[model samples]
Target chain A: MQIQTKAVNGVLTLSLDEKRLDSKLAVGFKDKVGELIASGNRLIVFNLSAVDFIDSSGIGCLVTCLKLMGPKGKITIWGLKPPVESMFKLTRMDRVFTLCSTEEQALQAVNS
Target chain B: MNQVSLTIDSRPENVPLVGACAKEIAGQSFSIDKLSEIEQALVETVNNCIEHAYCGSEDRQITIKYALSKDRLFVEITDQGKGLDPQCLKKLTAELDYNPSDIDCLPEGGFGLNVINSCMDEVNYRREDGKNHWSLTKFVVPLT
Candidate 1:
């Protein structure tokens, strides 16, 4: 799982460069985000434009990443395709994470 | 009915193979959206078996049998680990009753069965002859 990261202002954007975020990549994804949070980058935006599929484990991994960030840290996700977005909504994770339609919106939410 | 059976180690690395098999089998009859849904449901179910059924034990084996007919697609996932808990099934089925309102109260896990149930037309689980059998069926009207 290759995640591209960029820093703008104070927020770090990590773009998922994969089509599927299933069991195969969930642990790796968590570890990468965990490393980022451990390095003092708390405010984060997950750009999932390229991802079209996410299983329950993938969703669980996202929650694990959020918990790893602790209380002071913040993480938002944006650019979810319809099918992937439906998973979040169906699982009620849409309420758990700050979801945005675009990267700019996610950046704003994380910065605010 | 046309059927294909695949047996793989209970490891995360083999999940994509299962997904690919599902897509290839289901794509022969269903639409793109339905194919995606079937693949997603299969992935969730198989991943659940890997995480909970086998408990991260890669030495175990998981078998997936897919049968496609004119009106329905049937999938059976068999595992040799511990059987499914009725209580977990009850909780997962109950989750479909309402949507949570608070972000802080959102559940991080326990959504695997729900995703499977929501995607497939029929979901059944039973312990038979010391193996856990998960049966999933999706109904589709064949394109004429």
Candidate 2:
């Protein structure tokens, strides 16, 4: 799995290039998200457009990221496909995180 | 073909390797749906051994063995750590109080057993010679 991060208009956009997020990639995932939050990038956007499969471990890693960001630091997640979107809904994390339909929408929300 | 046997050493680092072997075995005979169920089951079971059986201790290795026949896929996952408690399996299988928020957020993980139970047709846990033995099976459920 590869993670690419860039700053756009003070919003950090992270694109995940991976087919699946499971146990094997969970730790590295946590580390990268932690690095982003620690770097003072409060407004974060996750681009999961490329992620096809996600399991419980993957969901756990993302939940940790959300918790670390806190209320002050906003995190918007975008581009979740069906099963991936279903997982978020199942876990009720879809409610906790500000989920956007597109990257542009997330960026717009960040700007607002 | 009678059956093919595949084995892998017990190590958290080796979980994915063993899981792949299980996936291949399951896919050999079953349809895609069964293949996915078995794969998810194996992935979760192996992850459980790696995370909880050893509790992140580097000293132990988790051994996985798979046997595939025309009728079913059988998997045995062995962990050289503290054996699993039967009560835990019962609770998880029943989905008793399995609130997602109750999940721990520590870099160390959990939930392997839950996913495994949800996916597998049958799950059995035992302890022999101080090693945790977990057997999972997903057979072709005959359509009525």
Candidate 3:
């Protein structure tokens, strides 16, 4: 999985540059986020605009990241395509994670 | 009707390959939405087989057979590993009957079977001759 990261107003925005976030890339995705968290980056936004497919393992990776970040660390996600959005809703993960429609909204969510 | 079969190692890396194959086969007749649903169900079923049936054993093999008719698409996923436990299947079916809205009580895992059940039109499981077989069907009208 290719992830592009940028820091804006102390918020780390990691954009997924892949079409699918399935089991194949779940472990690597988790590791990359782990590295970012280790570097003291707490407020994170995942831009998933390009990803159209995600499976259970992919969802598990995100949950794992959220748990690792703990309560103080904030993680927001935006740019979820409809199918991917539906998966989050089906598993009720949409409730657990902060979801936004655009990057700006996600930034505001993390900032708030 | 047309049919295609795929055999892959029981590994996470092989999932995308099999998924692509399924998409290509199903895409021949169904709309993108239907294809997406089938792919989602297919991934969940294959993932379950890899995780539970094979238990990460790379040596094990998974065979996926796709049969496409005018009105429906049929998929059979088979693994020659430990078959599914009947009690667990019953429990999962029960869990899928209710959708919990509470995030605090939301389950992290054990949602794959539910996803499959929700996406596919019909789902059945059987174990015979030391092989676990999962049959999934999706009814669709071919795109004009």
Candidate 4:
């Protein structure tokens, strides 16, 4: 999995360039999120526009990123497609994270 | 053959393939309950192997075996890594002090073994021949 990070208006936009996030890629992705958190970027916008699938481990990684950010920080998701959205709904995690329609909307939500 | 075997690399990208294999069998008519249980347990168990089993190794493989019968389905997943310590598992189950707030603190990814234990009718673990062998079973619930 490849993770690219860009910051605009205090929102750290993380684009995941992979097809899925399961056990195999969770750790590496977790570390990247950790790095962002450690870098004092409290507001996060995850662009999963490229991710087509996500298992529990993938969801776990995102949850861990949120926990790592603590209560004062926020992480939002944008462009969640089919199976990944199904997963979030199955676990009731869609209610937990901020879900936006597009990357631009996600950045706006976080920036605002 | 009594069972179907699938080989998956230790990479996270194969999670869907593993899930699809299990789901194909479990997602028949009115199999939602079973699908939910199997998906949760399978992901948790497989994630355990992926995140902790081979922790830092890149050349290892995780082998998954599936067996279906009229009454129950059996799943066995094996990983090429240092086996887990029974004593540590005992400690994890024995101690209930930590609040399950953070995802990383979870023993098995998000839902952890608790979900596996709840979803599957039986769960067993053993270490043999330098491999971690974890087994899970679920009985097909009769139609009401």
* Candidate 1 local Cα displacement, residue A96, angstroms: 2.1
Model 4 residue A42 CA deviation (Å) reads: 2.7
Please name the candidate that would achieve the greatest DockQ relative to the true structure: 1
* lDDT digits (tens) for residues B16-134 of candidate 1: 88878988887878887788788888888888888888888998999999998889999999999988887778754665443444334446677888888888899999889999899
B9 in model 1: Cα distance from truth in Å?
Answer: 1.2
Per-residue CA lDDT of model 3 for A1-71, tens digit only, reads 69999997789999999999987898899999999988888899999999989998888888777667766
Q: After best superposition, candidate 1 residue B25: deviation in angstroms? A: 1.3
Looking at model 2 chain A, report the run of 10 residues with the lowest lDDT sum: A87-96
lDDT of 4 at B44: 73
Comparing 1 and 4 by DockQ, which wins?
1
Clashing pairs in model 2? B10-B61, B10-B62, B10-B63, B11-B62
TM-score per candidate: 0.91, 0.77, 0.91, 0.65
Q: What global local distance difference test value does model 3 have?
A: 0.85
What lDDT score is found at residue A10 in candidate 1? Answer: 74
Q: What's the count of clashing pairs in each model shown?
A: 0, 4, 0, 3
In model 1, the Cα lDDT at residue A110 comes to 91
lDDT of 3 by residue, B44-104 (tens): 9999988899887877899999998888999999999887878777643554433333433
Residue-by-residue lDDT tens digits, candidate 2, A1-112: 5999998778899999997788778889999889889877888889999986667788788878767776666777899877567656544567656778999998887767
CAPRI-style grade of the A/B interface in model 3: acceptable
Candidate 3: segments with Cα more than 4 A from true spot: B95-106, B141-144
CAPRI docking class of candidate 2:
acceptable
10 residues in a row with least lDDT, candidate 4 chain B: B91-100
